[model samples]
Target: MGAGGGASATEGDPFWRRAAWVAVLAAAYFVAGRLSLALAFARLAAPTIWLPAGIAVAAFLLGGPWMWPGVFLGSLFVSAASGRTAWVAVPIAAGNVLEAWLGAWAARRFARGRAAFERPRHIAAFAFLSGAASATVGAVIGAASLCRGSLLSWDGCGATALTWWLADAAGIIVVAPIVILAAMERRDRWNKEKSAEAGLLFASVLLIGWAVLGGAPASRNYPLDFLCLPVILWPAFRFGPAETALTALVLSGAAVGGALRGLGPFSRGNEIETVLLLQSFSAITAAAALAVAAVVAERRKDQEVLQGSRRSLEAAVRERTETLTKTLGELESEIARRGLVETALERRTRELAHSNQELHQFAAVVSHELQEPLRKILTFGDLLKGMAADPRREEWEYAERMEDAARRMQRLVEGILELSRTTGDAPPLGPVDLGEVAREAALDFEPLVAEMGGNLFIGPLPIIGADRAQMRRLFSNLISNAYKFRKKEDAPRIRISAESPQRGFVRILVEDNGIGFEDEFTEMIFKPFGRLHRRADYEGSGLGLAICRRIAMRHGGDITAKGRPGEGAVFAVTLPV
Candidate 1:
C-alpha cells in the first residue's frame, strides 16, 4: 500500500509541473496579444494585423495540443481587454481558439507532421491550410460577433470581415513558419562566414524595407515597393528556409505598419483598401520566398546524399580489385611451378630414349661378330664328316650332330640381329599400297607354301602412311609362321583380309589353319625370344612374331593374337590410316 501511494505521487508531480508551466505561458501570451491588438487596431476596433494568431498556431504545432489552453486564455484576455463584454468576448475568444485548433489539425493532416519547412511542398501546404483556410473561419466568426454586439454596422461588416481575414492570413503566413523553422533549426554555433553572410542579409532587408515602405510624407507617390524582392531573395538563395522566413516576416511587419499609418505605396486608397493591399503583397512575398528557400535546402540535402553513395561505391570497387589482383598473383605462381615440372619430365624422357637406341645397336654388333665363328665351326664339322679315312658309322653320326648344332647356333645369332634391327629406328613413312606389299610377301612365300602343300590368300588393302619395307616384313613373318605351324594331317589354309573398322584406322586379320596354342600364351608370344614350339620341332629362333610385333609398334600400330588349343590362330593388326 505504501509503495502504490509513492508511485501515484511520482506520476502526479509531472502533471502539477505541466499545469504550472501552462499558467505561466498563458499569462505571457495574454500580455503579448493585448499589446499587438492595441498597436495594430483600426478605427472599427479590428486589427489590421493579428500577430497572436500566428503565435497561437506555432505554439500548438511545436509544443503540441497541450498548449491549447494557453491559446484560449490568451484570446479571452485580449478580447475582454479590447472593451467587449463577457458575452461578446467569450465567442470571439472561442473563435480564436478554433482558428488555432483548425490550423494545427490541417498542418498535421496535409503537411505530414510538424511544419519544418524543409521542402517546397511543406511550405505551400502550410500557406494554404493554416494561412488561408484556418484564417477564414476566425474571420467569419469574429465578424458575426461584431454584428451581434452592435459594434460594427451591417453595411460595413463585409469590408471589415475581409480586412480581418486578410490580416490573420498575412500574420500566419509571415510569422508562423518563421517561428516554427527557427525553433527546429540545429543548435550549432555560427562560424565567421555564416555570421557575416547573415549580418549582410539582415542589413539589406532592413534598408530595403525602410526605403520602400517607410516613405516621407511628401514622397508617397514614389515607386519603390518592388525593390524589396532582391533583398528577400538574398537570404533564400544563400542561407536556407529559416533565415528566409525570418527576413520575410520582418519586411512584412514594416510594410503593414507603414501602410496602416498611410505612409507607403499602398496608402493611396481608403484605410481598409490600404491594409488589404499591404497584406496581399506581404502574403505573396512571404510564400514565394519560403518556397524557394525550401527548394534550395532540399537540393543541398540530395547532393550530400548522392556524394556519400558515390564514395561508398568507389571504396567497394577498390576492395574488390585488390582481392582479384591477389588471386591472379597466386594463379601465376602455380603456373610457373607446373611449367618447371613439365620441363624436367621432357628432359628425362629424351635421355631414356637415347639409352635404348645405344643398347639396340650394341646387340646388332655382337650378333654380327658371333656369326663368323659359328660359320667356321659348321664348315670344319662338315669337312670332317666327309673324310674317307674315318670309316666308323658312330664317328660320322657325331660329326653330323656337331654340324647341325653349329648351324642352329648360327641361325640363332642371325635371328637376334634381325630382331635388333626391327626394334631400332626405320625409314620415315609415306603413302604405300598395303595390298601390293601383301601380294609381294605372298609371292616370296609361294614356293615355301607349295613345298608344305599349303594355300595362301590375299585381300585388297587400303593405301596407308607407313614404311613399305616394314609392312612387307610384317606380312612375310606371319605367312611363314602359318606354314611352319600347320597340322601334319591337314594342308595349311592361310587367309589375309583388311577392313576399315572405324574412322582413322584399318584392321588386317591374318587367319591360318595351324596347330594353335592356348589363349593365355597370346601375350607371351609377342615378347622377345618367345615361342610356342620348341626349336627341334618348329626350326625357329623364337623371334619371328617378336620382330613382327616390334615392326607394328614402330609404325604406331599394334598386333594381338587369338587362338584355341586345336583351332587355327588369328593375328589382328590395327594401324592408323
Candidate 2:
C-alpha cells in the first residue's frame, strides 16, 4: 500500500465506509486472539504465537493512524472476556495500541512503511525496529497488568514477559508479511506457471515439516530440524515475500504442534525452554526467508531493466535507419519541385505588384473625384430647400432626401479611403499610453452616453509598442458598436479593462451589456461591408470592424469578439508590450 492508498481511504471515505472497515478489523483481531489463546500453556499469560500482534501492526500500517480505536476496542474486549480483571484490560489495551503505533511509526520512518519487504535493507530495519522493539511494549505492559491484578505470581512475571515478547516478535516476522504482501499482490502475478510452482513449493514444505517434526512419526524425532532448511529456501529463491512468509508459517505450525506433543527436536527442553526455542527458530527462519526473497526480487528487477534498455536502443536504431531512407527520397523529389516553384513564384510576384498599384489608383480616384460630386449635391440640395416657397410641399421633401443621400455618400467615401490606408503599409510603432487613448475615445461618446443614461469606463492599460492613432481608432470603433447595438429597455453598461495574460503580451477587453450578435457572425462581422442590421436601423458603412482588424494586424496584434444572442459581448485585443 502507498501513502495515498491509506490516506485517501481514511480521509476521503464517508463515515459509514470507514466505520465498516474498523468493525471488520476489530472482529479479525478478536478472532485471532482467541485462536492464539488456544495455543497458550495452561495458567500462563504466554502463547506459542500471538497472531493478533501481527494483525495490529498490519492494520496500523495499511489503515493509517485512524485505526487505533479498532485495535484498542479489540484488545479490551478480548482481554476482559478471557477472565482477566476488568480494570486490568484497560492498561493491556492501551499497551497494544501503543505497540502498534510505535511499529507503524518506525516502519514509516525507516523501513519503507508497508513496502518493507521489497528490499533487503528495509527488511532488516523492519525486523529490528518493528518486530523486536515494538513487541517489548506489549509484553511489559501485559505482564505487569497480570501481576498487579493478582492473576499471576510475581516470580513468574519475568519468564512470562520473555515468552510474550518472543511470541509477538515471531508473529510480526511471519504473519505480518503474509497479510500485508497478500493484500498488495496484484491479480496479474498469479498465472498457470506461478500457480503450479507455488503449489509444488508449499506441498514440499508441508511434507518435509511433517516428516521431520510430526508426533505420529516417533522414529523421526532425531533432532534433524535442520533438514527443513532446504524446503524453506525453495520459496525464498522462487517466489516473493508473501509466499516465503506463508511457507515459514506453515512449517512453524507443524513444528510447534509436534513439539507440544513431545515428538519433535524442540521437545527435548523444558516447557518454557521449548517454547522459546521454537519461537527463536520460527523468527530466524521467517526473517531469513524474507531477506533472501528481497535480494532475489532486486536481482530480477535489475535484469528486467537491462533487457528493457537493450530493446529500446535497438528500436531507436531501426527507426533512425528507416527515417534516413525516407528522407533521401524526399530530398530528391524536393530538388525537382523547387525549380517549378521558383517559376510560379516569379509570376505571382508580378501579379501582386500590379494589384497593389491598382488599389492605390482606386484610392486616389475615390478621394479626388467621388467626394467632389457628393459635396456639390449636398450644397445644391440645401439651396433648393431654402428656395421652396412652401417648406411642407413635396418638392421640399425631395430636397431633404437628396441632402441625406449626399451626406451618406460622403461618409461612405471617407470610410473606403480609411480602409484602403490600413491595408497599404505598416504604421510606425512607438510606446503609446493606451490608457490615455482609451479615455480620449470615451470622451467622444460621453454626452451621448450621459443623455441615454449609460456609462463608459476606461481602465488602466499598458504602454505598448503600437501606433497611437490606430489604437485610438480601435477603441473608438469598439465603443461605438457597443452603444449602437444596445437594447432600448436597458441602459448600456460598458467597461474597458486590460490584463497581462502572458509574459510578453497584454489583452484589452471591452465588455458591454448590449444586444449581442449570434456566434456564427463572430467572424463575418470583421469583414468589410459585413452588416448585421439594416441601414435604416443602424447607420454604418460596416467597415469599422474591418478597419480595426487591419490596424491590429499592422501592429503585429489581433482582435477577437465573443457574444451570445442578447446577454452581452466582449471584444478582446491582444498586443505585445
Candidate 3:
C-alpha cells in the first residue's frame, strides 16, 4: 500500500508534469532535426541546415535550465540515428547540448531577462552573442568528433567546421526568437485590418521568394531576391516581434531551399561555399527584421504611456474648474444679499427725514396761532391796571405782574416761530456778500452798543451761496449773544471776522469780551431752549443760538463755540462758498 501511495504522489507532482512537457518537446526536436539533416545531406562536410539548435535554446529559455536534459536527449538521438558510432555520437551530442546551454545563458544574461527582445539593442545582442558566438562551440566540437571517428578527413575539417558553425548560427537567428515570442505573445483578437495586413504580407513574401529563388534555371539571371525584403519589413513595422520573426523565417526557408536545389543566386559556388552564402543571408535577414520590430514595439509603448498621462491631466483641470465656478457662484449670491439690505436701510432713512420736516412745519404754524391769544391777554391786563389805579395797591401789583408774564410768553412764542422757520424749508440760495450781511447786523445793534459803552467791529467777508435773510439772521443771533452776555466792568468789545480756512468753504469768527461759561457747555448751548443763564439774568428766550446752528446746518455747514470762565468767547460758523 505504501508503494502504491508513492506512485500516486509522484504522478500528481508538478515536477512530473514539467518533465512530461520536456519529453514531448525533445521528441519533436529530434524528428525535426533528423528530417532537416536528411534533406540537405548531399555533402557530409556541409549539412547545410540545422533546426534543432534553435529549438533547444528556445526550450531552455521558456522552460528554464531543467529543460537542458531535453536538449541532450534530442541531440543524442539525432547524432546516433545518423549511423555514427557511440564515441562519435556521444561527443557530438555533448557538443550540441553545450551549445544550447551556452546560448540560453547568453540570452538570459545579455538579452535582458527572459530574452524579451523589445528593444533594438537587445535584439542585436541576442543575435550576435547567442546565435553566432555560442554556435561556434558546437561546430568546433562536432567537427573534431567526426575527424576522430574517421568519418571526416582533417584536410576538410576547416571547411566542415565553417559550414557547421554558420548553419547552426543561421538556425538560431531564424528560429529561436520566433518560437519564444510566439509562445509568450499577447492573445489579443486580430481585428479586420490586422488580418488583412497579415494576409497581404504572407502572400507577398511567398510570391517574391518563389520568383527570386524558385529553383528554376531562369531565376538566377533576374537577381530579384531583394524584393522579398519589403514583405518582411511590412510585418516588422505593423505587428509584434512574433509576427516579424515568423515572416522572416518563412522567407529564409524558401530562399535556402532554392539554393540547396542548385537553382538560386547562392548555387553558383561550390557546395560548401554555396551553403555558407545561403546561411549568411538567412542570419543577416533574421537579425535586421528582429531589431526593427523591437524598435517599433518600443515606440508604441511610449505613445501609450504619454496618452494616459494626458488624459489624467485633462481630468484634473476639469475638476478644478468646476470647484472654482461653484465658489464664484456663492460669492455672487452673497453680494446680491448685501445689496438688498442696503436698499432697505436707505428707504427707512428717507421716511424718517420726511417725518422730521412735517414736525417743523407744524411747530411754526402753532407758534403763530399762540401769539394772537397772548396779545389779547396783555391788552386786557393793561386796561385793568389803568381802570384800577388809586383804587387799591394789591390790584395795582397783580396787574403789573400779569403784564410782565404776558410779555415773556409773547417773546417765547416769537423765538419758537423763528427757530422753526430757520430749520424748515426756505427760499432758494444765491451768491450773497457775507461782509455786507455782517455790517447790517452790526448796524442794527449800534444803538445798544453805544448805550452799553462798547465797540462793535466788522471785517471783510467772502461771497457765499446762501439765502440772504438766513445769512443776516445767522450773524444777528451771534452778535446779539456777544452783546447780551457782556462783562459790566469790561465795557464789552466785539469783533466779527471772516477767513477761508480751506477750499470751497468760509469760516466766520465772532469774538467777544463777555462773561463766558465752561468749555463743557459748548455743544449744550446749541440745543433748543438750552440756556446757561436764568431768564431773569438775560431777559430773552434761550432759542437764539439753536436757530443760528439750524440755519448754518441747512446750508451744509456747521457752528462750534469755545469759551472760558472769565475770558471772552468765540463762535465759529463755517459755510460752503
Candidate 1 lDDT for residue 514: 86
Candidate 2 lDDT, 1-577, residue by residue in tens = 1122223335457889777767777777788888878766664678888887888888888877788777788888788679777778989888888988898898899999989998989988998889999999999998898889988899999999999999888887788888788777553557999999878887888777777866447546366777788888888888777888898988888778777678777775578988898888888889988999889977877887888888898888888988988998799789769968987898898788679858866896766689999989999998899888688988889999999988888877878888887777578889999999999988978888878898988889989998898899999999998988888888888999999889999999999999899999999999989999999999988889998988878777899999987888999988888
Query: What lDDT is obtained when candidate 3 is compared to the true structure?
Result: 0.81
lDDT by residue (1-577, candidate 1, tens digit) is 0011112112234777556545654675677576556646356556766777777677667666676677777778877677788777777777877897788788888875454477788778988998899999888888888888888888878877888788778777877776666656663588999899888888888777776876555456678778888888888888877788788878876776677676778775677677777778778888899899888877877987898888888888888888888888888988888888888888887877788788888899999999988888888877878873464777778888888888888878888898888778765899989889998988977777777787898888899999999899899889888877888888778999998879999999999988888988999998877876777788877788888888888888899999877778999998989
Top TM-score prediction, candidate number: 1
Best by lDDT: 2
Tell me the lDDT of candidate 2. Answer: 0.83
The positional error of residue 316 in candidate 3, measured at the CA in angstroms, is 6.7
Score candidate 2 by TM-score against the native. 0.56
Residue pairs with backbone overlap in model 3: none
Per-prediction TM-score, please? 0.73, 0.56, 0.61
**Better TM-score candidate (2, 3):** 3
**Model 1 stretches with alpha carbons more than 4 Å out:** 1-39, 42-126, 149-156, 179-192, 199-227, 253-274, 298-427, 530-543
Model 3 agreement with the true structure over 62-176: per-residue lDDT tens digits: 7666776677777778876877888997888788888988998999899973455798898888889999999999999999999999999999898889989988898888888
Model 1 residue 182 CA deviation in Å: 5.3
Q: Model 3 clash tally?
A: 0
lDDT of 1: 0.78
